[model samples]
Target: MKKVAIQGGGGSNHEIAAKAYFETDNIATVECNSFEELFSTLKEDHSIYGIIAIENTLVGSILQNYTLLKDSGMVIIGEYKLRIKHQLLALPGERLEDIREVHSHPMALAQCSDFFKQYPHIKMISRDDTALSGKWIRDNQLKGMAAIAPALAAEKYNLDIIAKDIETNKRNFTRFLIISHKEKIALEDILTQQPINKSSLVFALPHAEGSLSKVLSILAFYNINLSKIQSLPVVGSEWEYLFYIDLVFEDYKRYQQSLNAIRPLTRNLKSLGEYHVGKRSFDTVSNDNKPLSEQKTF
Candidate 1:
């Protein structure tokens, strides 16, 4: 049984993503309070894997996480995109009207801000983790308090979901990266188990005219699709930036050739990882706002 590090409680989205991406039921979780702890855990124990949420459709990129990945010596072995569905959960026998305060992570609160517009009397509070808030409410036997978290969190803490799908966007999704020590991500196994279709790269170019455009042209010539590109300012280098790009290609050989052709054109270019792209899939969790008893997994 493999032990994975997640940046939250047992029922967090990171745990959910780690389970789904690895497709294992026996794996155990080592919960970390922060991303820095997650990376350090992996550094100390090369055998342990990690899952970290990198971006969300509604919140955009987590810039700090991007910087962490660049500095950390972890390798991206795979990815998972989980549909984010926020449920308002409270103690059993408690209805929505009985709830006077709702607690959740700041991002969760922001995502479900529109839903609370109708309930002006209810106070909104931000906490460290969504699942932790639910656990706190349940363990403390707090009345008139609800938590905005995932259904899994409610189930874990034995709370009743009073409201379902409270997020402002129904199509909200978060992308998580499955990472591990470089040695643990064997290139041979990835090639055998999954076809490599996508890769992430970080590089900086000379401050010359058309430098970025020329790199884009080379990628296009090799039929590589640029799914995402983000630039972060380099430390101590005024105005210069490092470009991080996600490339998807149909042919692995072509992707290699493209890299070879463009290596000289780049400076300090780093191949983050090569793996199969992940798809966004909605889980069967009563999207129609049904009760917990009537809910089923999709």
Candidate 2:
């Protein structure tokens, strides 16, 4: 009976990731029309958890959400990397030839751009949510319109899959972060509950040259591996930047030591969260040769 808040409606990839991370089919969703609402919902109801897409392999980091996460004071408890397979779905009884317009999230439309090239007559329309497009088409019994979304959306919205894996790159993936109220959940408690090998951190460096390099050297000396690093310009300060990084480590104590070692070198060092690096479940191979999107349970 776990209730989680997602940025999109039911059958959205956020909900899909939540189910995978929580490992439950019974989790209820508090759907928010937008990401801003998603965080606000959690603030109003501390008991409700939240899942949000942080980054995608095809697209870059969601920079705005980083600011939201930091400002909202939510703690990242877990993460999930979902393989994004875009499917073209239409209302039942409609064929691909009958569809003239395809609707989806902008990113999804971009991913399936190559697939639509064959049908230049079909126009691509961007929407706020991929699954919402499907739900809209279904609930309204719309015709001649299709949605580019996950297969789950097709199933959930009772849409016929006109096409499967339409994304230009079969390797597309989106990394989602699971968050909760900081006061409601303790970092130590989450660390004990899960095998935390990965951590996200944000910090500001001194203006001096090699200041960032010094911090990197210290982490390398501690046997920490930098998986991802992103730099966002500081708004008020011209030419100043804040660094957000993802680190993976084998030894928890060594990782802790690395953080302590870098604190002196960083101006505002903050450990965003420490959680297990999400496994790519959609990359699994089945003996029957079925697609990973079809084989995945959730």
Candidate 3:
């Protein structure tokens, strides 16, 4: 069985995304209590793969994960963008009206904030994992407790769905990165799955005016589209920053040329990955429905 490491329990979004990306149910989930533990597990077991939530539409980015991914030295084999739909789950016998306290991850709670406003009686408590909260309620047989988690958690933990699709916005989604040890996954193996058209990179440029602009100009000149770009500070380097970017392109040769052209302008240029961009998924609609992620170029 394929072993996938994720940051949470069986029914969490991380596991859900892994299943969708791998397109297989015949796998074992290695759940970790924290992201640190997840990376540590991968470090110890190179054969194990990891799925992580990098950014969410409702909020912004999970900044710490960028640092983790950068320092882990893991290869991004693939990516999956999951539409987040948080369900309210409770014990089998408990009704929504009977619930006095609702627990979930802080991010989930924030997404469903509008739903909670209608029921002032229920107090929102932030926990480490949404799926774990449901398990706790089920195992303890808590009557007055409910958990804001995915629908899969209800089935996995024997909880009933007290509510469904409680998120305030329908566009809420989280982008997950599938990563593995550099040696375990060959580039040819990933190529067989799909043609690569996207690349994620991180580089530090000289702290001078127009230095960053020059790199971007080179990419545009080569027909490369910028998908996402993020900047973080370089430790111990005063006022200096590290640039992390995701570039997408249709022409492979031009993409290669763009990288070579920018090498002279960038220092410590490293590729996070070069892989196929994932299809946009909005509430499981797939390709039939128009999704937002496909509409943007930069």
Whose lDDT is greatest here? Answer: 3
Candidate 3's displacement at residue 54, Å, is 0.7
* Range of the 10 consecutive residues with the lowest summed lDDT in candidate 2: 289-298
Instruction: Provide the lDDT at 25 for model 2.
Output: 82
Estimate the TM-score of every prediction: 0.89, 0.91, 0.92
How much lDDT does each candidate structure score? 0.85, 0.85, 0.88
| Clashing pairs in model 1, backbone N/Cα/C closer than 3 A | 284-298
lDDT tens readout by residue for model 3, 235-287 = 89955889889988888888989999999899889888788887546565344
C-alpha lDDT of candidate 3 relative to the true structure:
0.88
Local lDDT at 27 for model 2: 97
Q: How far is candidate 3 from the true structure (C-alpha RMSD, Å)?
A: 2.3
Candidate 3, poorest ten consecutive residues by summed lDDT: 284-293
Once superposed on the true structure, which residue ranges of model 2 sit more than 4 Å away at CA?
235-239, 284-298
Model 2 Cα lDDT, one tens digit per residue, 120-210? 9999999999999999999899999999988888889899999878889876778899999887686336667767788889988757898
Give candidate 3's error at residue 266 in angstroms: 1.7
lDDT by residue (1-298, candidate 1, tens digit) is 8899998887788877788788876789999988999999999998898888888988888888877888999888788888898999899889999999999899999999999999999999989888888989999999999999889888889999999899998767798988888877763365468778888899998878998889999999988888888777777884387898988877999999999988999888888778878754564543644321221211
